[model samples]
Target: MGLGPLEIGLIILAILLLFGYKKLPDASRSLGRSLRIFKGEMKGMKDDDVRSKDAVSTTPVRGEIVPPPAPSGDPNAQLQEEARLAELRAADLRARADQARSSDSSR
Candidate 1:
């Protein structure tokens, strides 16, 4: 069964009471901006996924004897690069977990 009119009305009334007439519009506008930002980021992520897939297709497979594409820019650059990439991956994982938690909470 779906939410009847009464339930929907009650939900609206609850929201109105919580936000008050003056702040409601501002709250809704902020929500709209947030949703727009979220939509744009999701689109960007899809584009990035496509690009990464293309990059992966050209990358060497495991156990293949592939020479390094270029010499290190600096002696310690490779080590720093690896550490930076590892940190980025960890951050991505944390963001995914946080997104999952927020979605679950919203439901």
Candidate 2:
């Protein structure tokens, strides 16, 4: 379900006839330049995307999760608060687990 060599040759022949031998070279040269410009623009867009991602991740350490700003707009304070809360949650869970174990042993 692809174009055979015969089909491809006929298409090329039709193009050459439409553009004529005199104009075909110029037309192909312009098409090549347009493709080159389009490729460069696509590469530029990818570079811009990478730059934007780097800008957003402004943390000093790579791959570190940045905590959202608190009401005071301090990133470090917000991170510390998040860490404190996480530690508290872990302690609560550990206490609950110990209580459960003690009850199970008594039973």
Task: Give lDDT: candidate 1, residue 59.
Answer: 48
Query: Distance from true position, residue 103, model 1, in Å?
Result: 28
- Candidate with maximal lDDT: 2
lDDT of 1 by residue, 62-83 (tens): 3344445347577587777556
What is the TM-score of each predicted model, taking all chains together?
A: 0.50, 0.51
How accurate locally, in lDDT, is each candidate? 0.75, 0.77
TM-score (C-alpha) between model 1 and the true structure: 0.50
Clashes of 2: 0
lDDT string, candidate 2, 1-107, tens digits? 99999999999999988989999889989999999999999999999889856754453223446455578777898888777755655565577669989999999
Model 2 misplaced regions, further than 4 Å: 59-107
